[model samples]
Target: RRGDDGTALDRLAGAITYAARLIAGATRRTGLREVYSPSSSTRGLRKLDSWVERALLEKDESLSTATAVAAEAIRQDLPPLFAEVVGRVLLRIGRLPRDMPDAGDVAYVPRAGHHMPLPPWLPPSRILGGFYVLRPIGTGGGGSVFVARRAEERHEETAETFALKVPAYNGAAAHTLSEEEFLRLFREEAGALLTLPAHKNLAGFVTFDAGAKPKPILVMELVQGPTLERLLDKRAMSMPLALSILDGLAAGLEAMHAAGIGHLDVKPSNVILRYPDDVGAPARGSTPSPTPVLVDFGLAGRKVRPGCGSPYYGAPEVWDTAAFGDRTDPRATDVYAFSCLAYEMLTGKTLFSGDALPVLIAAHLTHQDGPESLQWLRRHRQAQGLAEILSLGLRRDPRKRLTLSEVRISLAELGRKRLASLSWPLRN
Candidate 1:
C-alpha cells in the first residue's frame, strides 16, 4: 500500500510538472497582461495529499475503502481553502472571484439558498434591505460580498454598478477585528480603492455602504470577467490575450502605486478581464479598449507587513520577517508581487511550484533566486525595453526594484510603441 501511495504521488507530481510547463509556455506566448494564474496554486493538491496521508495514518477502514480518497477529501476540503485563497488573491489583484463551474469540481462560493445569517451584525432583512440587495458573490476572512443594486439610487452623473461587502458570522472574528475594526478596515479598503480613480484596468469604489451595520460595506464598480487564475486551469490563454491582460494589469498597478496603494496580493485570481460595456466604454472610434481590471483592496494598505501576505506572491523581502513596518515603503511590496504575477503570466505557472506548504515554506524561510523570467531577461541582455523594465521590477532587493512610478512610465512608453504601430498607415 505504501509503495502504491508513493507511485501515486510520483504520478501526480509528473502530471503537475507537465501542466506547469504547458502553462509556462502558453503564458509567454500569450503575453498575459494580468498576473493571475490558477495554475500558480498547489492548494488543491495539498488538500488532497494531506487528506490521503491523514486517512492512511488513521487506519480508518471506512475512509480507506473510499475510491480515490484524495479526490473526495479534496472536494470536501478544497472549497474553504479555495474561498480563502481566492479572497486574499482577489483583494490583491483588485477583482472578485467569479462562479466558475468549469475551473474545478469543487464550488467554493456557497449558493444563495445556502446563505446563512452571519452574527449580531447581519440578518437576512438587513442584507436584503441594504442600499441594493443582490445575492452574495464571494466570502473571505474579512466578510461576504454581494452583487448589490442601489435601492434609493443616486449617482453623481457617474452612476455605476456596485458590490457590497459585509462581515461574516465567525465567532472568533470578534476578537481579531471588532465591529469598529471591521468598519475601519472597510474605510481603509474604500479609501485605497477610491484613490485609484477610473481606469480600464482598475475597479473603483463609488462609496462606503455605512447605512446601518457597524461593520460597513463598500460600494464599488462591478467588474465583469472571470479571474485570470480560473482561465489558466481550463486552458492556456492565446499570446495576444495574455499580452492584453498583462498590459491592463500593469497599468492598473501603475495607478494604484501612484495613489499610494500597494496591492499586496498580485496573483492570477486578483486580475480580471473587464468588458467594454462594464467600464462604460463608448463603442466608437479610437477609444481605449476595455481591459483587465485589478480588483480587491481588502489586504491593501499603506504599509504592507512582511510575511503578512500570500506566500506564493510575497516579495523576497518577506523571507526576512522583520522587514516591514511603518517605515517600510509599500511600493517595494507591490514590485515583488508585480514581478511574481508577471512571471506567472509569462510562464502560466506560479513563481514557486510545489506542494503549497512546501512552496510557502521555501518562500518564507529560504533564500532563492527570484522568478526564472528575471534570469531569462538577464541572459538575453538585449531583449527589449519592456523586458528590461520587467527585470528591474523583478529584482530581489526591494531597494533595487523599479518604483511604481517608474513601472508606469516604462509601460506607457511600450503603449506608445504599440499605438504607433497601430496608427501607421500602409506604405504603398
Candidate 2:
C-alpha cells in the first residue's frame, strides 16, 4: 500500500509538471514579454521539484506551505501571470493529505485518453463574449475571478483589462446544486448588481453573460491594488488611513442600500484599494492616495439568510437559523459586518475567534463595546466620533442599527472635522 501511494504521488507530480509547462508556455505566448528567461525557467522547475519532494516526505508538515514556497519561487523568477497559473495548480494538488492512501488519488490522475481537471486559473478556449482571460485575481464562495482583456488587446497594456467571475465550486459544493440552479443563482446576483448605478467606491459592472455555453459569467472593472486583506497581512495602516478606507466602504454600501440591495459579505477580503490615479485609468508615474472599493456580491441579496456569510464577520441574526424565515434586513447585516471590519482595522485583531458557529454568534450577541483594544480610539476627538458612529452601526438589532446612508453621513462629517484640524500637506 505504501509503495502504491508513492507511485500515485509520482504520477500526480508528473501530471502537475506537465500542466505547469503548458501554463508557462501559454503565458510566454500571451503575455507582453517573456515571463521568464531561459535560465530562470530552468531554476524555477528545479525549485518546484524540490518543494514537491519535501512536501511528500514531511508527512507532519502542511502541504500548503510547500505550495507557497513553490509559488513564491515562480513569482520571483517569472511574470505574475505565469506565477498565478502555476500557483493554482500547486494549491489544488496540495489540498490532498500528505499521508492519504493511493485510492484517494485516482481522481487527480488521467485515464487512458482523458485529461485531468484544469486548474481554475487556466483560461478556457472560450471565456464568455470575446474576453480573453489573463490570470486569476481572487476566489471565494464557489467562484473564481480571472483578470481578462478584450480580444483586441495590446501585449504591453494593462489599462483595458477586466475581471471575470465564473463558477468554480470546491468539493461537495459542486454537487450541492444542479447546473441549472447554479445559473439561476448567478443570474439573480447579476440582476441585483445591475440595479445600482456605477460609483467610484463600488466595483463597476461591465457585462453579464447569461447565454454562455456552460454557465453565466460576470464581468467587472478590475481595480489595481492589493485586497484590504492582503494589505493588512503585510502591515497595519494609520488611524487616518483606516478611517479613509472605512469611509469609502460606507459610501459603497450606502449606494447598494439606496438601490434596495445589500452586500451580505463585507469582510476585508471583499474590499480592494486603488489609488486616486489608479481609478478609471492606471497612471504611469504618480503617488495618489488610496481609495477603497467594495467588491464581490456573491452572498448579497435583498434579504438576509442563514449560513450566507463568513462566520467571524457575520451578524448575530445571520447565525440564528430559526430567524431566517423572518424578514431580516440585509442592510443591518452589512452594518454589523462593516463594524467587524472596522474593529479589525483599528485593533489589528479579529473581533471574534472561534471554530464553532454558536460561539461566534454568542460573541457578537454578548460583546457590545466592540474590541477592548479599540477603546483607546475614544481618546482622540475625531476618533471618538468615529467610535460612536461604529457603536450605533454595530447594534445587534436591525431596527436599532444605523442605516447605511446615516453611517456614510456620519463618517463624512468626521472626515471634514479631521481635515479642518490637520496640518498643511496632511490636510489635503
lDDT leader: 2
Q: Residues 370-404, candidate 2, lDDT per residue (tens digit)? A: 64534655675544576687778777666788887
lDDT of 1: 0.54
Candidate 1 lDDT by residue in tens digits, 36-83: 232323445444433444444454333232224333333343344543
For model 2, the run of ten residues with the poorest summed lDDT: 1-10
Error (Å) of candidate 2 at residue 360 is 3.1
For candidate 1, the clash count comes to 24
Model 2 TM-score, all chains together: 0.61
Give each model's whole-structure lDDT.
0.54, 0.65
